[model samples]
Every structure is written in C-alpha cells, then in structure tokens.
Target: MSDLWLFSFMDDELREKIKIQSEQTKAVVYSKRTCLRHNFLIATSKSYTENSILAYVDNTEMRSAVKDIQVYHMGTDILVKWQINEVPCKSDTFRVQLLDYKYQQFAETQAKDTSTVLFNNTSPEGIYHVRISWDVYSTVRNLYTHAVGLENVNHGVPAVPHVTDLGNARARVRWTTNPHCTPDLIHVHFREPSSIGLLKVIPGTDETTVITGMKQCIQYAIQLGFSYTTGKEYLSDPAYMTFLSDGTFHNAPKLSFDQNGSLLVQWLLRPGCIVNQTVVTVETNDQPAKEYNVTGDQPLARLNDLEPCAFHTVYVTIQYKNGNVERTNSSEIHSFTKEIGLTKIKTYIVDDVLLAHWESTQNCQALGYRVDLMNPTTGQTKAYLTGEMKYRVSIGECVKSCQLLVSAISVDTMVPVTTLIDVRPERVPAQPRPPFVRRDGPALFVWWTEPNLDLTIQSYKLFVNDSKKMIRDFEVKQPRRSILLNNIEENVVYSLNLRAINESGESQPSLSVQYKWNG
Candidate 1:
C-alpha cells in the first residue's frame, strides 16, 4: 500500500460527504519518495479496477481558500463576488484588493458581513484578489484572483424598442443599445395575449429586424434584451403595439428586355402608404444575386451585363414606415437571355470545295449555323444556314478569294465568328505540260494540254523571244489552249515559253522550247 493521506477535498464534494449523499469516492495517494500527492474521483458504484485515470502529482499547496469567484466591470465600477469554503472567525474579516496585471495591489478593502465589494472609478483592465483577514501577518498569500477587462462590460439595459405593423403577418422591430455596452446578441421577446411567447434572436449589429408568422390584426407585447460578450444579460421594460397588417401591394411588376439585352423592371407600391426606399434583386443561374437600391418614387430599374444564355429571376422589396418591408404579391419574374456564342472555327479546302467547320458550344440552344460567304472581288455575300457542324461551298471563280463568317443561330441571337480563306490555287498552275511549238518562217504555233481545268486559272499566256531577249507575247483564254504568233523573226533561234494567269497573279514560266525559224 502507498503511503497516502487525504488532507482536503473540494467544497462541493466536502458538502456532499457531510450530508451523507456523496455519490463519488475520492482517493488520494502520497508518494513519500517524491514528496507529491495524486488525487482521483471515481463513481461510487464502479470498482477502482474498472476506472482509468492518469494523475500528475505536484508539490503545490491545497485548493484556494475561496470558491465560485467572479469578476465583472459594470459601468464605471469594478465588482468582485466570491464564496468562502469555511466559516471565518469573527476577527478574520474579508479583504478585497484590486491589482494590476503584474499582481501589484493598487486598492485594498476590509469588510465584515459581506462576500462582495465594488471599486468605484477604477481603471479599466486589472485583476481582483480576495482573501481572508486584512492584516499581512494573518495571511500567508492571496487565495483567489480573477482577470477582468472593461471592453466587454455591460452598462445598462437597452432602450424600449419601436415596432411597426406590416401587412402579411409581419412586424418590424427597431431598437437602440445603451451608451457603453456592446452586446453580442439582441433578443426580441414577443407574445400574443394569453399565449406562449416566442423569442427571436439576432446579431448585436442589427438595429432593425423583421418577425413573421404572427396572426394578423392582433396585439402583441414586445420587449428587447441584450447579451454581452462577458456572459452578462440585461432586459428592457415591455412595450405594447397592435399589429394592423392592413397595407398591401396593388400591382405586379412588368418585365422586358431592351435592345441591348438589359432587363427593364417596373413595379408599383401601395397608394396611401409612404415608402422609404425600393430594392430590386436580380438572381441568375449559378451566380450571386445582385441588388439595386432606388428612391421610393422610381418604379423602374435596368439591370445590365447579365450572363448570356441563362435564366434570371427578378423581384422587388419595398421599405416603408419605421423600417418595415413589404414584398410585392406577384414578385417573381422569370426571363432568359440569348444563346452563347460559337467556338473556334477552322477552314480547309479539298478538290475545289471549301469546307468550314466549328465546335458546338455547351448549353447553347442553337437551331442551326449560318455560313455567309463574301466575295472580295465582286463584293457579293451569300448566306447559307445548315444544321450540321460543317458547311461546304464549291470553290468557284467568283468566290475563289472570299471571307467566311460563321454564326450560331438561335431564336433571338446570331453572333458570328469570322475567318478568311483563299481557295484560289496559291501554287502557280502546275507548270503546264511542256509546251509544244512548230515554226513556219517568222511565225509559230504553240499548244499545250490544259492543267486539270483549274477554276483558279483565268487564262494562259505564251512568250516568244530571240536568243538575246523576249520579242513578243500572246494571250489566250480558256478552252483555246493554242496560240498563233505571226511576228517572229526568220532564221533566228527563238525561246518560247507559256504560263497560266488568274486573280492570284501569274504562274511560273513553263519549260522553254527552242524553235529556229528559217523561211
């Protein structure tokens, strides 16, 4: 067995043991080797082998001489309250002292027949120390101390609140806090006559709030209270108000979209009641709602820059007398924006046909795609609509060089994505099959096979030149691949070459053919 002695027990446990009602058993173990004591409190019904407890032993003194000590700052006074664990001797009065954070006493008091004391006009942040006996010789050390800060003190109760009746089973409440107390919560206690009351709690920062779900045309008793950060509570006197709930909205809001896609909303208010302000809330899919506040006289609000291809919900809230809010009867107005735009577009050519393709966007309600081809040469534009993702146009002479504008067409919108493509053969007509030449005394006949009848080729050209320089040239149109030259010199070795020509400039000269003309 360990050498142990139970020197003292906590106040509550000691009281329970004295009354023979202690449902817990406490065991104290003293380690004579280490000069430390370990204490444990276990359920009286449970065996010591069934409970687990790890206790650290220290050589410190026993529990403080006082229990249930609380420190508070109310208004300009610092208040300390405590309970003694044992009855004091008549000569051993209570001593209360106010100390700084460093535990240096600044104010001290001796009182008999009192368990609490107040220090008037003291500084804000400090600690309070209380112990038995006023003389230093009678006390060994301070028994209990508590830290208090003036920042969270409760000064006084909140002023009586003002209540207003709003139609549709609602009432607005407004209140003001005392000068020095900053509460953490505001409680609005309201009760209908002869019925159980309900309490609504709101944040301390709110001076105005609304309570709903009450019976109309009934009188209610309303009161306000505050709860501070220091766990202190204060309540105000009750005030009476009758809920009339007679006001109502007369007209529903009208909604429309302008040409620029801005939402135009118009609403009306009750005729006789004076209004404070109007608030319009616009909510869109997957986005935070936006609010617009306007004067009471203005009934219209235009919301701009909304998401395209999304649904929007609009509503109006009216603020009237004594911060009361009333919502319109036909509140919700639903509308949709235009479809989204098209994605990246790509253009390619295959065998005299121009093909334009693009990606279809998600969440877009497009009926079809519109492909518009504009001829840069003739300045003519042709529009074609197709439901497929790709569109093909035959590369003709008129549209060899054109700009294509592709747009996704929906019920209400058509936004275009444009790209330029040159269908005209960029490589000069494949060097025409070696030109054939025959000379007849100062004249020559040249002919060659047409190169695949390319649409990019407008015509052909033949060059006749002497060994020194080019002498003459002849032009030939399509379908007449041969040209006759009459102005060639006789007995001269001439170099003859041919080339193809179109809107995209000229092709490289074909292989030169030598023909000596001797007449």
Candidate 2:
C-alpha cells in the first residue's frame, strides 16, 4: 500500500513558457524519500502585497557553474525568492520565460532567494533579468538592487570561517560581513572532499589568520566575490563550497580551522572516486592540497631548527594556465614576541660559532650554546659562562649568557641539539645554609640549608629590608623549604637571608638572620 510517486505536475510547453500566473503556485510537500530530483525552477515573476500572491521566479535551467542562480532583478513589484526541487511534471506549477533587455516579454513566476530587490524602473534607471527560450529569445540580464538585495547578504564576508586558533601549519578565521561588501571584496573557497576547483583567498582584512598545513582532514569554504580593499580575494562562487576542518555538514561548507594545543593535521587526500590509470580522474572529493611550486615568489619558508614559541603550518601552492590551482596557507598562530632588542656577537674564547634558526617541531626550543671563557681554577671546571637548558643548566661567572631552545611544533615533528663550548672552566658551587632562625607567630622563622640539588628550582630568594624594599619568593618544586615573615610591622628587627638555585646559577647569601619582633 505504499508505492510513492507524486510530481505535482506542470507541462504544456512548460505552461506556455510561463510569463505570469502559476495560479497560486506553491510547493512544500516532501516525503517521497525527501525529494530533490535533478532540481528545477521556471515561472519567473509575481507580487501583490496588499492581499495575496506574495512572491515568485524560478531558475536552475542548469548550465553548470556549480551553484547556479544568476542575475535576477526587481526594484519593486515582484519580490522573488526561489526553492523547488522536482515537483513539476504535471501540476505543481513551475515555469519560466522572463526577459527585458529589448528582447522584451517579462513576468513568469515562482523563483527565490529574495528576488525583486528593485526593478519596475519608472525612471531611476536600473532593472533587468533577461533569459529566455521558447520563442522568447533573450537569455541574460542583471540589475536588481539594494545592491541586489545583497543577494541575501553576507555577500562573502569570509564564509565558512572558523578559527579557535588551529596550529601546526595553519588555519584561522571569523566572518559575517558582505552585503554589497566593500573594504575588500571577497572570494575565498577551499576544498578537500572529492576535490577540485577553489581553495584559497584572504588577500585583505587578513582576518587574524594562519592556514598553512601538514594536512589531517580538510574541505573549506568562502565565496561571495572580492578583488579590492585589504583582503584581495579574486572572484568565484558556488556559494564558496565550505569545510573549514574538523567534521562537516554542508551549509556552504562549514569546517573552519581548529588545532592549537597538541596541534595536528597531515593531509594528502582521501574521500572517494580515484581512477588514475584509465586517464587520471582522481577527484578525492573536489580538491585543495597538492600544488607546490615550492618557492616561486617565496615570502617565508624555513624556520630552521624550529621551536621557540612553538606551533606552525606553512603552505604555498600555485598552478595555472588552465588547469587552475592556487593555495596559500601559513599558520604560526601569531604570538611571536621576541624583540627585546640588542644583538652583538663576538667570541674569541672559542672558534667558529655559528647559530642559525628556522625549525618547525614548533619553533625548535630556543636553540642553545654560549661560551665565554678565561677565569677558572678548580678541577678545570670552575666555569665562567655556560648554559645547556633542556631540563636546565647555566654554570656562570656572568659575562652574559642565554641558552635558547624553545618549543611549539608538533606533527611533522623535529628536534636536533648540539651544545659544545668548553672555554675551560668548571666547578665552584657549594655554599649555603647559614640562616635558620625560627620564632614563628608574630613572624620571623627563616630557614636555609638546601642545596646540592639537581635542576628544576624556579625560586627561593628572600632578602628583606636594606632598602631592597623587602622581598620574598619560593617555588622550590620540592623539598621542605621555609619562609614566614608574617605580621611584622613591629618596633621591628629584620635582616633575613637565603639564596640557592639549581638550573645552574645563584648561591651566595646565607649568613644573616637577625629576628626581633618586639611589638
């Protein structure tokens, strides 16, 4: 008792090439397995407002540019808005034949995305939507206003954008501005789902970005059409086929970037349909990724040794003549502050000291080694200036020292280290534990005697009163260290001391401890 077959019906040379009156044409009944057959739209115009007949105009005569819906007009009098997928073979009423550019003959009905933005042209000059066939001739006209109803707005304000800051090659975006859009026309579209076609654009507003890639999974989107202003995206539309990354649906392609923290993604291709031998038709879902001129124009590429702040994603793909391919992705996620200023190197206590940078296991962790010798006696290891830094180390006499080796890169991972500079100097650390006066309560219970540690000791420096303004600190990572100065505003008596560090420096202070809180 269930066969299902209902086409709503509309035929008669497509209803005399429909130029008005679809006789209250309406459709909103789907269950025949959801419906959407080859899609169609024909009736070209209709409006009344004061009582009945609200809107109409149908299109998708189908020619293939992907997202078909071109040049429709209406200053006032026919407000259009279309959406009909398979319903007229006999009666659901859907037909078209609207024209105006001198070929004349206008007014069909049922079509939309907010049609009729303006065009009853009394004189203000502007109104068009020509396209026909069925003895009507004309086929293309465009004017419609309010900037063409903004096409329905968002004109392309960076569509399908998403960027909670994804990293390891790049991806970042946030959008919602494009209605006749200016300040940087837009046209950005990316793909990675049965790929082929559009996949890049941001030449303006730059919108806090980062979209380079090692690839994990992708399919992007953005398209309205832009070519001026700050972000210079060319022009192309199919609603911008979006898929920012993550998981996706298809609103216009929504997958917008996301990957910071443990940073991931390493893509090549995979979705479906790939027959490369019989003539190479490998469209693993549209296309986006696989076009590397390597460095044709080259702006940046080679963050050597990598690992200072960590996090990266770089890409550059360009190909065109007819085959069409354009790409540009770079993601460091911006947060690279390292400009304190001052860099003057001169080392004679050693030979050939060359340190280069540009690595991406997320910025190569600081990049180490610094040596300045001459001044040591003990076991020849009394040290003058030295720093190893991994877990920690910086034996010093202080002529100046900094052992860099930062971190951020994650996937296409990397880590290479070499620290060798022996200006000959070592050993001379071991002298702590002299102050330990406990009085507790009204405050004054300082203690010290901890040293001979093995790395990781961020704090433990307490020098009070002497115009040093009174200081205190502690983060010994471990060990039961102590420091309690409490309510001491008394006819006071303070002069506490203690110093000890093991990341290689600091240790000379532990002989003063005079406590007297005679309130």
**Residue 99 miss distance in model 2 (angstroms):** 29
Q: Which residue window of length 10 is worst by lDDT in model 2?
A: 275-284
lDDT of 1 by residue, 172-245 (tens): 88887654345567788887765856565666556888888766434578888776544556667777764544
The lowest-lDDT stretch of 10 consecutive residues in candidate 1 is 11-20
- Distance (Å) between predicted and true CA of 319, model 2? 18
Local accuracy by lDDT, each model: 0.63, 0.35
Q: What is the lDDT of residue 56 in candidate 1?
A: 35
lDDT digits (tens) for residues 1-519 of candidate 2? 212221222211122122333454444533232112222233232322122322222332333111223332222222222333332221133233344444354565432332222223321223444331121112222212111211222232234454443544355544454333332334445445456434344544554444455244333443334443222343443332222334231111111122232322222322321212111111112333332222333222222222235233434333332223434333233223332222223122111122223222223233433332222332233222222322222334433332333322224432233232332212223446666776777667776665566444445666675333565554443465766667576665667666654434455566776666565
